[model samples]
Target: MSESKKFSVYLMATLPIVFWGVSFAAAKVALEEADPLLLLFLRFAISLPLLLALAWRGGEAALPTKKQALVLIFMGFMGFYFHLGIQTMAMRTSGSGMANWQMAASPAAAALMSAIFLKERMSRTGLLGALCAFLGVTVVLGLGTKGAKGISIYNFGDFLITVSMLNWAAFMVVTRWLFRDGGYPPLFTIFWEVFFAALMCAPTLALLRVDVGAAARFGAPTWEALLVLGLLCSGLAYAFWYRAAAAIPVPRLMVFQFLQPLVGVVAGYFVIGERFTPWLILGGAMIVSGVYAANSHK
Candidate 1:
C-alpha cells in the first residue's frame, strides 16, 4: 500500500480501538442504571435495525444457508452473548485496566487454536511474546493475593475477562473459516450474529422485567451515551473493524488491540476515578511490548 493509503487504514483501524476503549467507561456508567442483560439487549435491539438497513442497502438478501446459519448461531452464542455478557459482568467487579489486560490474551488464544485446528505453526518468538504478555497481565492485576475480608482476594473479574478473550478468539477463527469458504458478506454475517444473539437474550430480559422507567429517566445524556455505544461503537466500529481486518492480516491487527487496554485503563482512571497503580503501568507496558513483538513479523 502507498504511504497515504497505509496511514488511512491505520487511522480507520485505530478509531475502533479508541471508541471501544471509551466504551468501557460508557458501559460502566450505563451499568450503574442498567442490568447487564438489559443493557446488552437494549444496545443490540437499538443497533440491529440500523445494521440491517445498511446490509440491505449493500445488497445483502436472505440469510445464509442452513449450515452457515447454524455456524453463525453458534458464533453468536459464544461471541455476542457469552463473550460480551461475561466481559460486562467482569467490568462490574474489576477495573477497566484489568479487564482490558485480560482481553489481551485473545491473540495468543487465537494462535494456539489456529495451530490446533488449522494446522498452522507458531514461531518461537510468537510463543515468547505470548508468555511475556501473560506475565505482564499477571503483574498488572497482582494475581494471587489475599483480601482483607477473607474472600481469597483473587482477581476473578480479570479471569472472567480473559475467558471472554478466548471466546472471542474462537469466534474469530470460526468467522475466518466461514468467510473464506462460505463466500458470505461480513456485514450480513455480523448482523445475523447480533440478531440471533438478541433473540436468545430476549427471554432473559423478560425474566428480569427491567424497569423501562429507570432506563428512560436518564434523559438526554443517557440516550446520547446509549446512541454512542450502539451506533458508533457497536455498529460503525464493527463495520470498520471488519473492513480493516480484511485489509490487514489478523496478526498485525491483533497488535493494535493492545492499545485498547491502555486507553481503557487510563480512561477508567480519569473518567471513573478508578485507582491506578505502578504495577498496572509496568504490566501494561510489558503487554504492549509483547504484542508488538508477536506481530512484528507480519
Candidate 2:
C-alpha cells in the first residue's frame, strides 16, 4: 500500500481502539446506577435499531442459509450475549479499568488458539512477546501473594472477566470459520450476530427483573454514558473496527488494541479515583509488550 493509504488505514484502525478505551470509562459510570443486566440490555436495545438501519441502508442481501444462520446465531450467543454478560458482571465486581486490562488477554489467547486449530505458526520473537504480555497482565493484577489479596474471590467478577475473554477468543475462531470463504459482507454477519445476541439477552433481562425505575433514577451523566456505550462503543465502533481490519494487515491493525487498557487505566484513575499503582503499571506494560512481541513474531 502507498504511504498515504497506509496512514489512512492506521487512522481508521485507531478509531475503534479509542472508542473502546473510552467505553471503559463510560461503562464504569453507567454501572454506578444501573444493574449489570440492565446495562447490557440498554446497550443492545439502543444499538439494535441503529444497526438495523445501517444494514438496510447498505442494501444488504437476505439472511444466510440455514446452516449459516445457525452458525451466526451461535456466534451471536457466544460473542454478544455470553461475552457481554460476563463482562458486565465482571465490571460490577472488578472495576472497569481492571476489566479492560484483563481483556488484553484476548489477542494472546487468540494467537495460541489459531496456532493449534489453524496450524498457524509464530516466530520465537512472537512467542516472547506473548509471554511478556502475560507477565504484564499478572503484574497489573498484582499476581504475587499481595496480588492474591487484591483478587476478590467472593466477588467472582474477575472470574467472569476471564470467562468473557475465553468466550471472545472462541467467537473469533467461529467468526474465522464462518467468514473464511468471504461470501457475506461483514456488516450483514455482524447484524445477525447482534440480532441473535439481543434475542438471547431478552430472556435474561426479564429473569433479572431489571428495574427501569433504577435506570430512570440515573442522572443525565449516567444516561449520556449509556448512550455513548450503545452508540459509539457497540454500534459505530464495530463498523469502523471491521472496516479497518479489512483495510490493514491484521497484526498491524491489532497493535492499536494495546492502547485500550492504557486509556482505561488512566481514565479510571482520574474519573473513578482508582489507584495508579506501580505494580499495575508494570504489569500492564508487560502484557502490552508481550502481546506486541507475540504478534510481531507471527
Candidate 3:
C-alpha cells in the first residue's frame, strides 16, 4: 500500500476499536437517562437511516434471500437480542471499563469454539492460548466489582459481557459457515444483521412503555452520549471495521481486537473511575497474549 493508503487503512482499523472502547462509557452515561431497552432501541433506531443511506450510495440492495434472511435473523437474535441486550442490561451494575476488558476474550473464545466444534486445524499454541484466556477470565471475575453477596453473585455485569463476547464469537464462527466463500459484501452482513436486530428489539418499547418525556428531557450530555452510541459507536465504527477488515490481511486485521480492551480499560478508569488493580494487568495481559496465540498460525 502507498504511504497515504497505509495511513488511511491504519486509521480506519484503529478508529473503530477506539470508538468501540469509548462507547461503553457513553452507554453508561446514556443508561443513566434511559432504561437499558430504551437505550439499546435508540442506538439501533438512529443507525438504521445511516445504514440505508450507505447501502443506497453503494448501489447495493438491502434485501436478502430466504436463506440469507434466516442467517440474518439468527445473527440478529444472537448479536442484538442476547448479546447486546444482556451487555446493556449488565452495565446497570458492571461499569463499562471492566465489561469491555472482559469482552476482550471474544476472539479467543471463537478460536477455541472453532477448534472443538468446527474441526478447524488449531495449532498446539492455539489450544494453550485458549487455556490462558479462560484462566484470565477467572482472575477478572475475582477482581471485578462484586455484588452485595460477594462471590456468590460475583460481578454479574462482567459475566454478562463475557456471555455477550461468546455470543459474538459464535456469530462470527457461524457466519463463516454461512458465508465462507465471501458470497456477500461485509457491509451487507453488518447492515442486515443490525436491521434484523433492530426489528427484534422493537417490541421492548411496548413492554417497557417507555416514557417519551424522560427520553426527551435528557440533558445535553446524555443526548450527546446517545448520539455517540448510535452514530459513531454502532454505525460508523462498523463501517470502518468492515472496510479495514477487507483491506488488511486476516492476521494483521485480527490483531486490532486487542486495542478494544485496552481502550475500554482506559476509558473505564477515566470515564467511570474503575480501579485498575494488579489482577487487571495480569489477566488482561494473559487474555491479549492468548488471543494473539490463538489467531496466529505460527
Cα displacement (Å) at residue 62, model 1: 4.4
Reference-based lDDT, residue 225, model 3 = 91
Candidate 2 regions with alpha-carbon error over 4 angstroms = 1-5, 56-62, 124-154, 244-255, 273-298
**What C-alpha lDDT do the candidate models reach, one value each?**
0.70, 0.68, 0.70
Where does candidate 1 have its weakest 10-residue lDDT segment?
A: 143-152
By TM-score: ranked, best first: 2, 1, 3
Residue-by-residue lDDT tens digits, candidate 1, 97-177: 556665666766776676677555556786677667667756654522222121223487767877888788877666666
lDDT of 3 by residue, 74-126 (tens): 87788666777898888888865466656666656666666566565456776
Which clashing pairs does model 2 show?
A: 126-294, 126-297, 129-290, 129-294, 133-287, 133-290, 136-283, 136-287, 140-283
- Whole-model lDDT, candidate 1? 0.70
TM-score per model over all chains: 0.78, 0.78, 0.75
Residue-level lDDT tens digits of model 2 in 1-298 = 7767766756666677767887866877788888877888788888877777777787763577898788788878888888887787777667664676667767667666766775545667865665666566556545412312353443578788788877776566556545555765667777788888888877876786777578768889889998998888888877666656555433334445665665655555566566666676676677556645654431
Task: Please give the clash total of every predicted structure, in order.
Answer: 0, 9, 0
Error of 2 at 243 (Å): 3.0
